[model samples]
Target: MPSFTLPRAFRAARITRTHKISAAVVASASCAATLALTAAPGNAETTAAQAPAGVKPVSANGLPLTAKDRADDGAKDRQVASSLTAGLKVTAVAKQGHTAKQAADRSADRKIIAAPKAAPNAAPKRYANNLDGWIRQSLAIMKSKGIPGSYQGLHRNIIRESGGNPNAVNNWDINAINGIPSKGLLQVIQPTFNQYRVAGTANKLTDPIANITAAANYAANRYGSIDNVNSAY
Candidate 1:
């Protein structure tokens, strides 16, 4: 039997076929890897777009906000708060001013209402009980009341009865024995004095003008006026 030996051309052709199969396998693996890599980018884009509703998109910084965007939002919020605070302060100041004005107005009204009024006029008063003053006062009253008498007639009877003593009292006389003393400047008893006392004259017995006027009135009714009386009746 002769030994069989492969020819050089045949061996070369088989090695070439093996190399081509290996290259084809390497090209197929590379193409599959390229397709996977290209699809990965599309999937990532799709996933980002399909995020949950109402969720904020991520910024370049990976957090919810970038540095410049966060600073601008913070500044705007601060400005809004400052404006509100200033407006409130202005409103409070205006309210306080109005309250103070009202208080001042009330105070002014009270002062006006509490002011004092002017006093009324008054008549003149008497100073003493002198004879001239008493006579003048009695004459004035007599004139107002329509009583008739004169200064001379009054003086004449006052001198004759008790010597012008306003307090004269005759306790030892006959009138005294009957429990009725002659009293005053005219020395007239209580019954006669009280009965004859003029309306405008003093009511007291010791009054000078009262005694003289009462005695004069009594003499006028009984003896036809004091001007005709010369002695003790």
Candidate 2:
């Protein structure tokens, strides 16, 4: 066999590099083509491209499409027409609605619990030191998770119940029947205590955040508001 020379070695190396670069380029082009094919039809627009005139279901690559992608193209015309008719600003419109809701929520919050106060001499409450912080956190949870009507009502009702005392309870049988741990701001009963399964466990009632959330969920579902419990008990 003839021995290979340096020039031949150099030629081989160049060829190998060229092959590698060619393979990479081909792979990249293939990927791009596949993505493009998976994208909207010829007339369709890419998601990165300008959004259409109205709310439109889009392919992965961002083109006007039907919700069910694999369906017949015939349905595409009518469905897309409906989508446009309903207002083509789907992404923008939905996002705008959410933004507006968040803005409104913030506006309402400013008016609601402007300066939540914690009595200096009183027992533990949600805002042991930072009343405003606690109120803000609670309000955020309410806005995001949709606080129940009862829980919402309880915001004012709680001023009368525990006066924001997370660890409040009746010294006498003023709140409950058995004198078991009617814990949290809601004065959650023993059965509810067992139901939520938070009795005397770790955090206990002093956990203002957990206590408030649990109490709010309970009040919202059970009595439709904390005021009902306040009236009954």
TM-score of each: 0.42, 0.34
Separate clash counts for every candidate: 1, 8
lDDT string, candidate 1, 109-207, tens digits: 885456665566755557357656665665565556555666776667677778767788888878889999888777888888789888866788778
Cα RMSD for candidates in order: 19.5, 34.6
lDDT of 1 at 22: 90
Model 2 misplaced regions, further than 4 Å: 1-132, 149-152, 174-177, 194-203, 225-233
RMSD of 2: 34.6
lDDT of 2 by residue, 138-232 (tens): 55565567655433465665566667787777656744555664665656665554454323333455556556555665666776654455553
lDDT of 2: 0.59
Off by over 4 Å in 1: 1-128
User: Lowest summed lDDT over 10 consecutive residues: which window, candidate 1?
Assistant: 47-56
Q: Residue pairs in steric clash, candidate 2?
A: 47-62, 54-88, 54-89, 55-88, 55-89, 55-90, 150-224, 150-225
Candidate 2 structure, TM-score to reference: 0.34
Evaluated at residue 128, the lDDT of candidate 2 is 36
What TM-score does candidate 1 reach? 0.42
